[model samples]
Structures are given as C-alpha cells and as structure tokens.
Target chain A: MPDAIDFWFSTGSTYTYLTVSRLEQVEAATGMRFNWRPFSVRAIMRVQNNSPFANKPVKMGYMWRDIERRAGLYGLPVKVPAPYPLQEFDRANRVALLGLEEGWGKPYIVASYRRWFVDGQEPGMEPNLSASLREVGQDPARVVGQAQSDRIGGVYGAATDEARRLGVFGSPTFAVKGELFWGDDRLDDAICWLKHGRLVA
Target chain B: MPDAIDFWFSTGSTYTYLTVSRLEQVEAATGMRFNWRPFSVRAIMRVQNNSPFANKPVKMGYMWRDIERRAGLYGLPVKVPAPYPLQEFDRANRVALLGLEEGWGKPYIVASYRRWFVDGQEPGMEPNLSASLREVGQDPARVVGQAQSDRIGGVYGAATDEARRLGVFGSPTFAVKGELFWGDDRLDDAICWLKHGRLVA
Candidate 1:
C-alpha cells in the first residue's frame, strides 16, 4: 500500500490553494496517496485563540506580494479578491465534505481551492460554486445541499477535532504516519517523511 | 539620524536569538541604530492564535528540530530547555527593558540571546540569568528586583500594548517606518525597507 498523507486544508486558505495544484504531482512522484481532510478554518482559529487577520496590516500587505512572487515561481496565476480572508469558506468547506463522502475528495479540493485562489472567485457564492461543480461534472445543487446535511456537518467537525488532536493550529498542515508538518513550506519535508518513513534528524 | 528599526523580540525565542546576532553585524556593516523593543512572546502568540509550546506537541517538536537545523546553518549551539515555554520571561523581559533604558539594549539583547540559544542555558533560570548578566557587569539581583517593580512592569506592558497597536503578532518582528516584517527570515526585507523606504512591489 502506498503511504497515506492526511492533508488538512481550509478552502479560503491561499497557501492551501498554492499547494493543491502541485500536490497530485508530488503524490504521483512519491507513490503516496493523499487522503483529503477538509476542515473549518474558523474552528482551528478558535482553538488557537486567534482572530483571523488580526493586528496585521503591513504583514498582510507583504503577504499579497509574497504570494504573487510564489505564484509566479510556481507558474500559477494570482488573483487578489476583495474583502480578503473570503468569508465564504463555510459553504466551500461543506461542499468539500460532500466530495469526501462521494470519493471524489482530491479533485473537489483541487477545483475548489483553484477557483478561490487562482480563479479569484468567492467560494460561498452560488454562481461560482455552481460553475466550478459543473465544470467538474458534479451536480452543484445536490453537492451543496448534501454539504449542509447533518452527516456532512459531522465530517467537517470530525476533521477539525482531528486537527486539534494532531496539534495542528493552521492550514496546509500535513501528517504522515502521525508526524505533523505545518506550513506550505514544509510540504517537501512531509513528502520526505512519506518516502523515507522519517525526516532526516 | 539613521533609520530606526524597531525590533520586537522575546527572550526565549531562538529565531529572535539568531536575528539579534546577525542584525548586530548588519548594523555595524550598514550603519543603522535598532530601537530594541522586548515584548511578551505569550501575548504575540495569543494574538496570532498560536498555542503555547505546552499545548502543541507537534509544533513544539517542529520548533525544536527546525531551530536545531537553522542553528547548525548559523553555527550556533542550541539546546531545547526544560519547561519549553519558560514562564519566567516576565523577569527576563524586565531586564531587557532596563537594558533599553540604559541605551545598551542592542548589545544586551545580543548577549542574552547568545547565552540562552548559543550556550544552551535556561534563560529563566536564576543561575543562567545571573551568569549572563554578570558577564555584562550588570547586577542581576538588583535588575531582577527592579524588573518586578510597578514602574518597569508597566513599561513592559506598554511595549506589549504597542506591539499590538503596531499589528505585531510574532517574535523577531521588525518595523521600519511603519512597515512590519515578521519572522527571522524577514530581517533582510526589514533592512531593505529601511534603506529603500519600501519593498519592491
């Protein structure tokens, strides 16, 4: 069996969006299977006792520039959406939970993140989400409604609970064989752990 | 007058240690004066929504291993001290405040960080603190007592409040002319901002 990587992600997370396009290529190269685990960014933020984007102006300004730089480096198109942090994550995350149940988790996560980060679309907006799902040949209304169901809500909650248990306080977190790696920058290390069964200590 | 780089740091922060040492050399080379501002790592962490080391095992592990790797790159000796968070930052921060008052803040921060991160000493431990202070010909007992006094304690509080107002949420944060650069990795950018008056946008 290929090594399984539990990918904890948030829909509105730019870093998570940055990593998604390349992740499948990484999995293919390393022969690792990514288990998509979508969770609420709000839930994780609550546990960490932080307000999203709190006390950050210049750093936030720098982040946009840095993201553009990184996106260019990766050959990805960058878009800066208005009302940053994009409060539409809830709807996006819900659809992600449905995708996980439908066994199309990877493609759904990739599409949703790309739509928000690269395509510059609001995640919770019905028209954009519908278009994204239609493009993927998944029924948008059904998927969105399913995402609102009690069962789908449970999945999202469970993922957040697991994130807390694993000591994950941020997005783009990766766990391989119970060892956690935080930040998009540490994706290579996570891959190394999967390939080698441990990090170089 | 040289551009003032406000350095917001914490005593037990390893990255801050590396930055402090390297920054001193940078100042000497480039001719700049740093207004060293010591603040509570706890407050910064809280504002950033990060868990203290005590609560996040994976983060704690990553931090230790990452610091070790970075220290090796910098040729700095380091040890993960007992009681990882080191609660006595209150006292250590007070001494730093005194150093600021005496106009010896730069060297004092550099020396103190070197003693902790480079020498593998517990910064909060009395013996280690005394040794570090005595090396600088400072009276540790008197400084410690004064640090606990209302006057100095108020100064530390004010610094933390100022950090919050400045949108600082982490250690090794540098603000140049109201532009903030966070993390040890951003020191170069901070210097660039000081010199160029803006980042390459």
Candidate 2:
C-alpha cells in the first residue's frame, strides 16, 4: 500500500513542511499510503539556476501571507516569518533518509516541521533537530551519528538524483505512475488521479 | 454585484486563460459579479527584474506539464507550447481596457483566451486579437483604432501601477476588498474569503 504514491520533499523547503505535517491525517482519512521520498530539492534548484526567493522581497512577502492563508484553510497551525533559508541541510536530510530506512522517518519529519513552522525554530538547526530526533523515540547521538555515515550519504544522493531524473522541479511533489504533481494545493488532485486517473469529462 | 470582486489579468499570461475562459461558468453558478481589471503584468515584472520562465528551460519544462495537468483538472482544453512571451502586449491590453469600458470586456477576454490557449494562437497578436474583438460584436477597425489613443494608454498605465501598489505579482489575480489572491487555483480560496472571511477551524 505504501508503494501506491511517491511523496518527494526536501527537509528545508517551506511548503514541504505543510505536506509532511499533514500526510498523517491524509493517510488516516483516505486509507492511502505515501512512500516518503525525501531528497534535496535545493540541489536541483541550484542545477537549474533558479532561486525563486533569493533577493526577491515582494515575492517572499507574498509567499509568507499565502502560506498563512493556506495553513488556515488546512486547519494547520503555522508561524510565518519562521526562521528561513537554513544554512546547512546535509545533516537533516541524511537523518531523514536514515529514518525512512529505520521506519521512524514519518514522525521525525512531522516533529521537525512542527518545530520549524509551528514553534518558529529554524529548520535543520541544532538542539531543535536533536530534540526532534528524540521526540520520535530515537537516540539523538546514535541516529544523528549514523545519519552521517557514507552509506546514508550515498542513499541520499541517489534519491535526489532519481527525483531530478523524474522531472521533479520542486519539493512536495507527488508522483503517481511516474507523473509528477507539484505543490501542496495539488494533494487532492494527486489522489484523484491515483483513483480515477486523468482525462475525465 | 460586479463591484464585489475585482478580476485582475494580463492578456498574455498563460494561466490567465484558465480564469478568463471559465469565469462565466463560475459567475453563473454563483451569481456573483467580477470587475474586470486589465493591466500590464509584464510591466511590473520588468521593474522587479524577475522572470520565472526566462533562461530556465527546466522550470519551463515543468511548468508546461503542470499547466497541462491543471487544464485537465479544470476541464479546459489547452494547447501546450502556445506562442509565449508575446512580443507586443501594449496594443492588445489597451483594447482590453476599451472593451471593459464598453461593457464587452468579459466576452472579449474569454474569446482572446480561447484563441490563445485552445487554438494555439499567440496572445495579443493581430488577426487573433482582431478576430477576438469581432467575436463579441465590436468592430475591429474602430475598437482597435480607439484602443491606441493616449487616454487608453493613461488608463492602462494607471491600472498597472495600481496593481503593483496592491502587491499583485502575477496575472489573473482575484482581489476582493483590496486583498490580493494570486494564481488561478486560488480563485475558490478568494471566493471563500469573500463569503466567510478567513480563520475558519
């Protein structure tokens, strides 16, 4: 059942927070499964020479307000102006990859997003990340250390490369039968496609 | 009722076609009014030094796919790779302004979008624009001529400036009570805001 959908996301993305935090409720309500496919969306953005929010004040302003409105519509709690643009995501993403392997990734991702988006903590940052790891019943030292191993590093890179090859241009994209559905707003659309497929009416 | 909602659009924007072509059905279903506000979104982008699709082939690739899926979801027929980045939009935009003034703006906008998106025609280009004008009972020679005058130019410029002031960064925005809602997918969200306001649990 978990193989039915591919949920592609990056740990540092603002909108990915929405998807990661809400997927549990979505899973419960619909009885559908999501294979959490965490990858580095920022790496792909760099390769494409696209930095949508960098040095764009007006767009940034719009994004925060847009996210706020969407959070309300989704009945999710979020703190706008959440410390953004985390300097380092390597450790966080690798840990996410490791957790997915160990079957604790879901809770870790959700808790981290809650801290970053609901508690106004900077994503992929210290004390915060360590705390998030602990919240999911994982030892901070052991998991964080194992997350940096070369094996996990290799796995993470492969996932990112695979996402890039799949024509995924951003975080929080859903893939069904290899077709990419981008953005959180398209969650239901992805589900609709999963059930009925396209070309209706 | 037309005064209740402000519909902001640029003739050449790809996604505006979705809103313009489907708005009549939306109006009929809801019995609400939309004040057509035609403006040059490109002018604002020029000032901001921002171009999402320019020089980014990969992003453009993703965008085309996204639009195709969305068109399917909305039940709107669209031609992928419709002539884009229209070279001269000034004349066509002025004509839209004139149509709005003469109360023919709705059909004129809808017809133009159908030509551009469904028929694979370049937006704001002659023959296409002229035919669009004729489709809605306006003379091509007279309306097209009057559309280029200085008075129309001033009105167009003011509308563009007003959109910029209102923090509109994209086309086909729905503005209600001076609050901005960007993107075609946000139309329902905008209407929800209009009817019930925000912060619903």
Candidate 3:
C-alpha cells in the first residue's frame, strides 16, 4: 500500500472531466499526491465489448443532464461538442504523456478538458492542442514533436496495459492501496480510503 | 416536482441491495417518503440490448469487490450467493407490491435482501420467500398466492413500464422532482437535491 492515489482517466470521458477539474482542490484539501495517468478508454471498453454511449438513448439523455448539473454544482463550464465521441484522443493523450514527464501534467489535462468540454473544441485538432500545451508553459513545438514520436506510442500503450492489469475498466478510476474505486462519484471515498484505509470491521 | 423520492430497484442487483439496506436510514434522516418501486432489471436491460453481467468479467470482478467494501462501510453483512444474478424477482416484486399495500414494504425489502445477499439463498426460492414475507408479518400463503396472480403480473409490468417512462435504466435509481439519480452512490446527492435543489449559476 503506497501513500499515493493513482488517478487514471481518458481524455474523452465526461466524468473524467469532472475529476480533472476538481483534482487540484481535492489535493490541496487532503494533502495528498496524485500519480496522474492517462489511458485510452476506448481500448479499455473494447476488452469488455462495451461502449459508454452505445446503449439506451433515454439513459444517455439523463446522463447528459446529470453531467450538466454536476458541472453546475462544481461551478465548471461545459458544452458537449457537435460531433460527439470524437475518438480524437491519440494526439492529446500523447501530449499528456509528454506533459507528465515534463512536470506540467495536471495543468495540461485541465486545459485539454476545458478545450473539449467547455469550449466545444475538437480534441487532436490543431491550434487547440498546441495552444493548450503553450498555455501550460510547455514549448508547443517541442512537446508536440515528442508527443507524436514513436516512443510515446509505446509508452501510452503500456499505460493502457497497466490500467487493465489494475482492473480499471472505467475512466476516472482512483486506486489506493491496490483497491480500485471507479467513477467520479467515488472520488471522495477514494481520498478517504487513502487517508484512513478501507472501512473494515 | 413532487416532494417525494421514487426509489427504484431490481431485487437481483447487488447495488440495489446496498441501497435497499440503507433506504430506511435515509428516509429517517431526510424525513421523506419513498415510492418503493420494484421492477425487472433484465426487462429494462433488454430494451438497451445489455445484460448486467455481460462480457465484462473484469468490470464485474471490480463490482463484486466494491459491493463488499460498501457493505462493510454500512455495517451490513453480505455473502454473494452461489450462481448469482438470480432473476427470480417477479414473484418477490409482486409480493413487495402487496407488502407496500400492507404498510410493511421496507421491512419486507430488508428481509428479501438479507435472504439473497446475506443468507446465500436463491430469490423466489420456496422457504426463503415464504420466510421473508412471514418475517415482515405478512400471511405467507396469501401473499404468495397473490404474488403469483395474473393481476399482480399486470401490476408489476406496469411498474416496469413506469420506470422506463421515467428513464430509469439502472437499479437503485432515485427520482426526486422528476430528476433521476441512478446508482446507490447518488442516494446522498438525491437527498441533498431534494433539500437544497440543484446548484445553479
């Protein structure tokens, strides 16, 4: 059991947007360190033959409303983009991996979420990607070059593999002491689990 | 928006078991009445082309662990029965409707959950269903007979229809003010929403 929280998320997840936006606040409040990890949620859901948005439209309607309401609760802005499930996560995820190595991971992730969810910008689309990196104080040209490198693909793939081994079938999963807590709703319990361990008899 | 909570659940769902066990506490604390609803999760899942335990063994593994952890947190005992996802909820649901009419719905639900999740008994199984109804002080023979009636079948089907109309795609869904909050985890938020309303800018 390590004294850190493994925060696993995908760039395209709406619930991940919630956790990403509020993670800084949670860290400050709990005095905890986060091991930020980015993975491909599509790959993960593939293993289970599941797609988040592949089911009932009625349920999806409620979910869209729920996310809006939750964002309002957190004072975060959101606007679902025109062309949805934009699997344009590869470049963004690669840059995020590079950002993690460069010590600007959190800000980069927050910017990426804001770009897609709040500003309705398509991920992996130019100007957006470069601008997000530069906004976080990273050199866009250099970071983007590194992000597009063959090496980053291997690294990203391994991270996705690691997520599978850790039993992370969903995005915004928080792992502490080898226990996995899935979904944004489990964020508070994940933090508490880190601070005091699992509730046991 | 009505001043009540619509509590929906599938007897065979593990998450629903969690909420069913704790609903009494919530009602006591919130001073709210629940429209205790019982419906077939399988019937609901079919509309979405999903099976609750379909092709997602890894996710299912995590879910089992999650339920156990939550059970401990709530000081509730649980033992996953052999051959799970017992879909014999029809008779039990019908009896539950009768129990609600008799003003013993909560106790009956609690007893039903205990039988399946704690005592490791199959749902709608002879001795178990009879014992649960009797424990809640209902006449077992009469309730069982009524539960198997064609009229009760119609009633149960209507409730399932109502759940779908209300956009209840999952178990342990809580509806207040026409807002559907799915999952046992959202029970607290649902209660708070009833108390304070949605947060808005």
The regions of model 1 sitting more than 4 angstroms off are A1-4, A21-33, A44-76, A79-91, A97-108, A118-120, A145-164, A192-201, B1-6, B12-91, B97-125, B136-166, B176-179, B185-201
Error of 3 at A124 (Å): 1.9
lDDT of 3 by residue, A123-179 (tens): 666657777877888778888788889999999999999998888888889989889
Local distance difference test values of all predictions, in order? 0.72, 0.83, 0.81
Candidate 3: lDDT of A134?
A: 79
Docking class of 2: medium
**Number of the predicted model whose DockQ against the real structure is largest:** 3
**What are the per-model numbers of colliding residue pairs?**
0, 0, 0
Query: What's model 1's lDDT at A82?
Result: 31
Q: Candidate 1, clashing residue pairs?
A: none
Q: Residue B71 in candidate 1 has what lDDT?
A: 57
TM-score of 1: 0.68
lDDT of 3 at B16: 84
lDDT of 2 by residue, B1-201 (tens): 633788888888877877887888888887778888999988888777668788888778777777887788778888887777886688778888999899998788888878877787765677688899889988898987899898999999999999999988788888986578888988887787888777353
Per-prediction TM-score: 0.68, 0.95, 0.94
